[model samples]
Target: MIERLSIIGVGLIGGSLARALRAVGQVGEVVGCGRSGPNLEKAVELGVIDRFTHDPGEAVVGADVVFLAVPLGAMRGALSAIKDRLDASAVITDGGSVKGSVVADAVAAFGKVPTRLVPGHPIAGTECSGVEASFAELYRNRRVILTPLSETEPDALSLVSRMWEACGAEVTTMSVGHHDEVLAATSHLPHMLAFGLVDALARMRENDEIFRYAAGGFRDFTRIASSSPVMWRDICIANREALSAMLARFGIEMTDLAESIRRADGDHLLEIFERAKAARDRYVDRVK
Candidate 1:
């Protein structure tokens, strides 16, 4: 159990983690730090955290663990703030969407990667983004991927793994580069597509009619368009290299599909649809 846990950026991710740990009696005290005073107060009022602070340095004073839940662009600032204040024995982890950028941020802030720092990303969330959107069960049945550096401590990795397990997450580890590439294709690209689709539709001359006549399929595919733009913007920029590669590949496929449709190639359309259906079916079955 963590005697004291410090959560930076106590919005959805951090607040949910604090609530999860407290729910299981795994944390003695949770200190939340964020920019908003009211949000911090609401976290305390909701009992997601035991206390609150605006200073990242102060929040980690006696914490046994520190969870960085800020956006990728803000990670360096937050890490720098608490770098010298963290307890020597405190284990640090994160819920950053991009592992590679986060590791770079830590290295830049600390002048070296700390062995106790475990860079992680949880493959879970709703299209919601505030303290009110947090829940103790957010990580339940979800996967949390940790990208630990070669110099990372074994005990630190184990401790972070156990904490996620306690939150009902299945923990796994991977190389930072591989994790970034995988997420760029799976998570980042999807979000970008959703946002771009919704934006393009909204800007059309028949936007009102299009939106009014939109069906469930459109809503389902673009649901992630409603997620926090600020956070997604940071993630896209942080993983731009891998994301750009994925986007280019997807664009090529889109061009091929468009050409097939223009040529009225029934076999090409049928084959592509069949492949997609089978892939989606396998994915859904595995998820279930």
Candidate 2:
């Protein structure tokens, strides 16, 4: 029942949400705001939103719902700018990958308005950004994680959940801490690995040769490496504690693999490879 919605940052997630919301008739009006004048103009031209602005305060002034889709590091700054002007009854949510930090920052910036804040992460994206990259089906069949604190109003939480559900997403509730921890393993760690592997390979003496000889496998493996550097950098720093734990666990498993390879333990290596293959196969089967 959100009559007026404002989407801040108008990047891949925000733009996609705007497009999906319109397609699903989830809101009466959708407005987009971002720091980039050209991007806001593009969003308006793309018909993703009814209007666009560069002012956060003006964007959320009368909105019934507001989504902060900026990078995690920019969350605080954006919230601070719009804090005073946001509708008291508006359900303020965000698309930030990291939740704990964002929740804390938003609460600190907005004071008692924390009750209106609902932290969420839509487990959907592409290696794309800006209004031009957005599609109405970007969130179709995707899982949307809603991290609502005890202080969060039930009506606000329900509104946010229903909005995402109408956008073709499956909504589920989770704690902000648990959401951050799980994402650190599933999404954040994989991105880090992709970035590191690509960087290490590109810096080698045979870098150009490797690129010339690369096939679909290598290309697919490094495809996410091309994602926005600023966004990934912010996510890495924002969730460093959880990411560090995941990295340490991965390192231990990697060390065991290396030890088996060094010892030429073919049987153990085969078992490990088989298990991994089976695990992936199981996931594929489930998806199908």
TM-score of each: 0.99, 0.97
How much RMSD separates candidate 1 from the native structure?
0.6
On lDDT, the leading prediction is 1
Name the candidate that leads on TM-score: 1
List residue ranges in candidate 2 displaced over 4 A. none
Off by over 4 Å in 1: none
lDDT of 2 at 58: 93
Clashing residue pairs found in predicted model 1: none
Instruction: Kindly list the per-residue Cα lDDT of model 2 for residues 82-148, writing each as its tens digit.
Output: 9889877988999999998898788779775488889999999999888899998998999999998
Give the lDDT of residue 201 in candidate 2.
Answer: 89
- Candidate 1, residue 242: the lDDT equals 96
Worst 10 residues of 2 by lDDT: 104-113
